[model samples]
Target: MASAFIGSSVKTTKGPSVAGTLAETVAAVSRWGNQPSSEDVEEMIRDSALARHAALVKYLENKLAQAKGKLKKVEKALAKVQENLEPTELPTDLETISDEERFLFRKIGLSMKPYLFLGRRGVFDGTIENMHLHWKYRELVKLIVKRKNIAQVKHIAISLEAESGGVLVSVDKTTQGYAIIVYRGKNYMCPQALRPGNLLTRRQALARSVELQRYEALKHHITDLQERIELVTSELEEMEAGKKFEVHKALYSKFDDGSIPNEDEEGEEEPFSEVEDPKSEEGKLEGQSMIPADCNLRYQAL
Candidate 1:
């Protein structure tokens, strides 16, 4: 009985080995002979897939590099805009310029009065309309100086209030020494303390104010737009880069799994075939026939 059991084991083992070897050989022939054209196409397909993956990698790298450059450029532009937006303090003392030095100021519809005062009274006062007109005069004077047509003025003074309570202006000439007290629409010659200087035009001052304000506003708007663009561009680049990385990973996995045909080798090892059970139905019948009568019939048949 022991010898019989050993023999049965040997048979089982030998049968599997012979069948496995036959199956391997048959599989090899079938793979080689039946689908040569399809195999070639599959190889080409795999090569194309690899090429596509490589191209994608290169594209993603280039995009990232470009995005970095663009981001840098945007940053520089934003910085420049911010710098330009900052308020520049005007000099308390006006710098002298050539007769041709000129600046333009747009009109802001405000009016002022020109006045001169001596002691507690006014010498001359007049209504001046439009602030931009004063700015234009100042610009013209600077331009004339820049062109060497006129000397630079050193001082400017203007009375902003009524002459009785305003500052004094004095004019001196070869034959006449005069003091002026000027308020809005009124002028008087009076003896009082005098303040001597050139005065800025109201038009010019208003124009400068408007220009400065507009410049600041435009700078802020540009800065905000640039920042938003930078954010969007960065996000887009990141998303595209992530997608590219995922595709590369999947392709690499495929290559590793041998799903892609081996380009260097003409052939590869065949996959093992699955074994099907022929006695499955018989086994089920025997399992169900557990009664004594069924067992006796099975013994008689054996």
Candidate 2:
């Protein structure tokens, strides 16, 4: 019967848990009467291990492919972000340059033709005529105007030293259109045209004075605001700290009861005895004697 069973097992090798059943199948193939061949068992184990490794390798290859795809997506996303954040360059035409160099020389020459006569004599002057000259002279005139306006607006003035060790007053509101000469504690106003020096007009001096006053006021206001902000900030910090301490104290004392001994109970005097003790008969006798003596003394006084 055992031999018959072995033969049946070997004949029907296909079953669940095929790898585990292979050992039983091999044993049955040997008829349970002899040992199985080592070469066949070794070959079967090698084939099973190779199949598992092949499946693992395929899974890893799929994972590697997914990782590469994800990396490519991330790189593309980074590139898009960088492109969006990049700064734009300004147009070349918007850049500042010398108008004389950019304009046609012929146009400039034609514009200056009318002014050529003015240029021949020193009395004739050159003003901003062409675009090139306008570009250059416009800013220069604007700066000069600004300086003159400042000198006129300011109440105070500045003086320049002349080559002859004399002083030239460039700006003075009281001494208008003239350079003031200070000598021997006296001022002598000279004609501005004849003085061969620059003079600031009244408008320019006043403008500068107003500008300086405004600047000083702004600085003072800023300083005051800063000081007030600091004071308020410090007070707020102190208040917050005090509040925190109060909250902490409340929390710490939450479990404590409010019961306390009264002032009278802490150090109170005993009341007079309402009833005499029976054990102190001597005290009762003395009380009775004192009452009788008091009554006899009251009768005698009456």
Clashes of each: 31, 17
Best by TM-score: 2
lDDT of 2 by residue, 64-156 (tens): 454355446545543443332212222222212233422322123222212111110111012112212333322111001112343332211
How does each model score on TM-score? 0.20, 0.21
lDDT of 1 by residue, 1-302 (tens): 99998887873443445546878889888888765587586556555545655554454445445445545655555454333222222223322222222111101100112211111111122212221233333321000001111111111112222212222121111111121111211222332333222222344333333344444444554454455445445544554464333434444533232432222431232343433322211111112111121111111100
Winner by lDDT: 1
Give candidate 1's whole-model lDDT: 0.30
For model 2, the run of ten residues with the poorest summed lDDT: 293-302
Q: Give the residue spans of candidate 2 off by over 4 A.
A: 1-181, 184-192, 195-197, 243-302
lDDT scores for all predictions? 0.30, 0.29
- The CA lDDT at 200 in model 1 is 21
Provide the lDDT at 235 for model 1: 40
